[model samples]
Target: MTATPTPSRPVWRTALLGSVAFVALLWVLEVVDQTTGSALDAEVFANGITPRDTDGLVGILLAPLLHGGFGHLAGNTVPLLVLGFLLLLSGVPRALAVTAVVWLTAGAGVWLVGAPGVHLGASVLVFGWLAFLLVRGVFARNLGQVALGLVLLVVYGGVLWGVLPGDPGVSWEGHLFGALGGIGAAAVLARPR
Candidate 1:
């Protein structure tokens, strides 16, 4: 007798699950940080990225998982879920690769040129995903993706101003570099193999 094949899940389901899991992680980390009296930002973990400091390098991996407060995390949640779900629609492996590029680029840029203070938040990834979604269609010459990108631009274009040095408390460097990373990823990943 022939065995039945298990049906694969839809890409949308996978994307939704991945997006929710990622957002949940951010919330859980924030809760732990707050409950521990902000110990994550304190001497114990010191999880924020500090410019040009050797000890602060660990933040490149952990900083995106943290935030200043619940308010901060909330501000990032919607954008993250939206952009992350769209990105993951391309498949998890590709999305992960794009994310790695943006993550490293944003963290390193902050470490190299950020102001003299600890930087922590998911904004870097948000900006990265934003830029990635905005230009990836153009890079791939996919009309559907191009249309989606245009729609996203209409919705999130105002935030692009964040790449500049406007807010003293905002890490514009992270935004700029995350965007750059996204562009670079699109050029590399969306190219014809």
Candidate 2:
């Protein structure tokens, strides 16, 4: 008997498109420089987003894709790639959908509980991805994966402290909400069948 060939991925094009679009969007935002403050200021969720109101909806999410500099965007690009790849491996459309829900959920929660100011950066994106990955490891009973997640958590986890407000020039609020977004994404994405 001949073995059946698996089907090609349907949404690979969309992921490619998203990656390109994300890079382009970063370039455009950098040139626009509408944060009305230092490049660093763009790190804030509200001010970083420009026009600043978020219209009370997509703002939760739209903020992460809007980065301040090449460095800031580069920071997020890898996670997007890594996490996006993982999401696609598990299931792309569902992964994207889960990410969207998590992003919005985390963003909104951050806005509500975070400090009263603008936030704009992919920090939340990073955290969300991390949470999702960590959760997956936990659920899969994969020792190596769990170890990797723990290492990531330990090395970068200190960054979480930056989310606190006491630190100067740090968007602790962004960090806080970003974490919430991540945990929320993990929960939703990992929900049982």
Tell me each candidate's TM-score: 0.96, 0.66
lDDT of candidate 1 over 1-193, digit per residue (tens): 9999999999999999999999998898789889999987775567689889998898888788889899989999999999999999999999999999999999999999988888889899989888998998888889999999999999998999999999888889988988898888898887655
Off by over 4 Å in 2: 1-24, 32-58, 140-148, 154-158
Q: What is the lDDT of candidate 2?
A: 0.61
Tens-place lDDT digits, model 2, residues 126-176: 666666666656655667667877877775566666656785544566666
Compute the lDDT for candidate 1: 0.90
| Decoy 2 TM-score against native | 0.66
For each candidate, the alpha-carbon lDDT, in order, equals 0.90, 0.61
The 10 consecutive residues of candidate 2 with the worst lDDT sum are 43-52
Q: Candidate 1, after superposition: displacement of residue 98 in Å?
A: 0.4
